[model samples]
Target: MSKLFTPYVIRGLEIKNRIWVSPMCQYSSQEGMPTDWHFVHLGSRAVGGAGLVMVEASAVSPEGRISPDDSGIWTDAQATAFQRITGFIRAQGAVAAIQLAHAGRKASTAVPWKGGATLSTREGGWIPWAPSAIPFTDGDPLPHEMSLDDTRTVIRQFEEAAQRSLAAGFQVIEIHMAHGYLLHEFLSPLSNRRQDEYGGSFENRIRLPLQVARAVRELWPEELPLFVRISASDWKAGGWDVEQSVLLARELSAIGVDLIDCSSGGLVADAKITAGPAYQVPFADKIRREAGIATAAVGIITEPHQAEEILQSQKADAIFMAREFLRDPYWPMHAASALHAEIGWPKQYERARR
Candidate 1:
């Protein structure tokens, strides 16, 4: 039997397969509410046979958005808007998941298609917040240094968002601690240069992320699993790396985190990275072995045999594909064919399955 097509369980949740749709931002929302575009974009993947179809990185608060158009779960109206999308995913036999995120120093930018530059207050951008007053790049506006109260507020925001996610019919929630976002900004010394307890030491730097995790886990039902996405390496010396990631994973696991969605290098713009197929699988393998927890491998992973090999060799517990899924929403169905696994196709598409 192909491990990639095998049923995987965590807590009380049994995902249909090891193939999962990773969160990919559409940068398409109005006032933090999802539209018909989101419904079709996410629902197509569920119908296409992914085990778990995750919504994009949804900001927990307005100020946490990477772009003005980013999705949010800060209000009841927004959560209600997500019900139809989640319901469709579940009905299609795919687990519905969402990533709760706070962009921090990276907040308030034009959408990627529109050049992705920083927007000023006149242009509808707010002052971004971070561990320190540093800007992501030299020419960018300096982010407001988050005060102690601001840190507490962020933890509360995550807790509240988890509540909203459950209300919205989501079965899984992945904390967005990866990329160059808020939590990651605190993890990397290159971005977080504060002298407070949230910075200056490994234990101190991880304080807030852990606090958010603990807060969410405490409020989130024990029957459900919690996942965290982390940048295993910043790809620069003196930045967050696999070692710190292993340690962080252990801490998160102790606090009831069920899996680590391992990815790498987004803390800074110029960090030297050598990317290729399965370049990030090593990070997952190392963290899984060292941290003694489940992990999801992501980044440039394409093809059926390659994904199966990663699982068969125990490199990662599951596969999280982003861009590849965009290319073929029915990737899992095609992969099952390649592996000679007799998985069922949706009834409506049965004629094409042969």
Candidate 2:
């Protein structure tokens, strides 16, 4: 039997397999609402046989969006719009998940194809928020340093977003604490330069992220799992590293977080990162071992045997594939064949299963 094709249980949810689709931003929403593109983009992956299909980094609030086109769940209408997508994923035997995020200093940017440059308020963009008034890029405008009230509002946003996710029919909620986003800014000393209780020292830096997790867990159903995606390493000296991630994982687990989705870098523009196939698997292995928690390994994890090795070796509890899933939405189906694992294909595609 293929370890990658095995069912994994967490809380009361049993994912059909270990192959999960990573949250990849589509940059195709209209005023934070998912359009037909989202339905098709996500629906195809469900049909493709992933055990879990996570929607991209959706903003908890409008200002939390990475770009004007990013998805949002700040309103009931948005939550209602997601019901169809989630229903389809469930019918296809795949769990539907959503990643709630705040872009922080990275907000107010144009889409990638539009050069991804920062936009000013006059140009239809709002000022971005961050732990410190620092710009992500040298020439970019400084972001608004979040005040105490701002922190409280953010916590409320995450809490409300979690409720919306549940109402939207999602079975899992993955908090986006990675990729240099708002929560990540507070965790990394490189970006969080505040002198208050939310900055400086390890405990203070983690205060807000912890609070958000606690608030979300309080309301999220106890039976459903909550996952957190973190940049296990900033890939720069004197920045957030694996040791700190292990500590954070422990705290999250205590607060009822079920899984740590491990990915590295994205804290700085110039951090020297050595990227390769399964380059990030070690981080997941270390966190799972040291933190005594479940972890999902991501980052350039392509191919069937490669994913099987990670799970068989107990390096990670699950696998999250991004670009590879985009390239081949039916990757899990193909991988099952490669591993000689007997799995059901969608009845609609049964003829092609042979």
Candidate 3:
């Protein structure tokens, strides 16, 4: 039997296979609500036979949104919109997951399609917040350093979003702690130059992310899986790296995080990231062995054999394919065919099987 075809169960949730569709921003929401775009985008992955289909980086608050058009779970009305999509994913026999995010210094930007630049109120953006008053872009407006009360509010927002995610029918919740977003800002010393409880030392730097994970564990069900995606390395000195990642993974697993989705870079513009197939896989491998936890490997993983090798080597617990899935939504079905593995296709499309 193909190892990739084998089911992997986490926290009592059984995924039919090891394939996971990584979260990619859709930038298709209006006022923090999901629309048909979301339904079709994520539902197609379910229909394509992926074991798990994770929704895009969903904001936990209005200001946390990367773009004004980003999906959100900050309110019940927003959660209501997601119910339809999660319902469809479940009906199609795939597990539904979401990446709850807060885009700290990177917030208040236009969609990538619209140039992805900082926005002003006159041009339809709001003030952004971060660990420190830093600007993601050279010409972007400097964000306000989050006050103690503001930090407290963000924690509450994440707790509330976790509740909303459960009510919206999500089976897995992944915290978006990667990129140069709010939590990532906290993790990387290059971005966070504070001297308070949330910065300076490694413990202080990782405080917020761990607290968020603990809070989510408190709010999220014990039987359901929880994931924390982190940029394993910021690709720069004096910033977050694999060593720190391993340490954090140990703590997170102790606090009930089922897996660490290992990704890399994106903490700043100056860092040089060497991107290629399975480049980030080593990070996952290190954490899985050193931290003694399951992990998901992502970034430029395309071919079926490439993904298979990742599993056969015991490098990661799962493969998160991004651009490959975009290129072929039915990759899981096609991969099963290519590898001579068994995974059921959608009933409606099974008749067209080659």
**Would you estimate the TM-scores of all the predictions?**
0.99, 0.99, 0.98
The sequence of per-residue lDDT tens digits that candidate 1 reaches over residues 125-239 is 9999999999998999899999999999999999999999999999999999999999999988998898989999999999999999999999889989899999999999989
On lDDT, the candidate that comes out on top is 2
Query: lDDT (CA) for every model shown?
Result: 0.95, 0.97, 0.92
Candidate 3 regions with alpha-carbon error over 4 angstroms: none
Which consecutive 10 residues in model 2 have the weakest lDDT in total?
345-354
Q: Which one wins by lDDT: 1 or 2?
A: 2
List, residue by residue over 19-100, the lDDT tens digit for candidate 2.
9999999999998999999999999999999999999999999999999999999999999999999999999999999999
Q: What CA RMSD would you report for each candidate?
A: 0.6, 0.6, 0.9
Which ten residues in a row are the worst by lDDT in model 1? 344-353
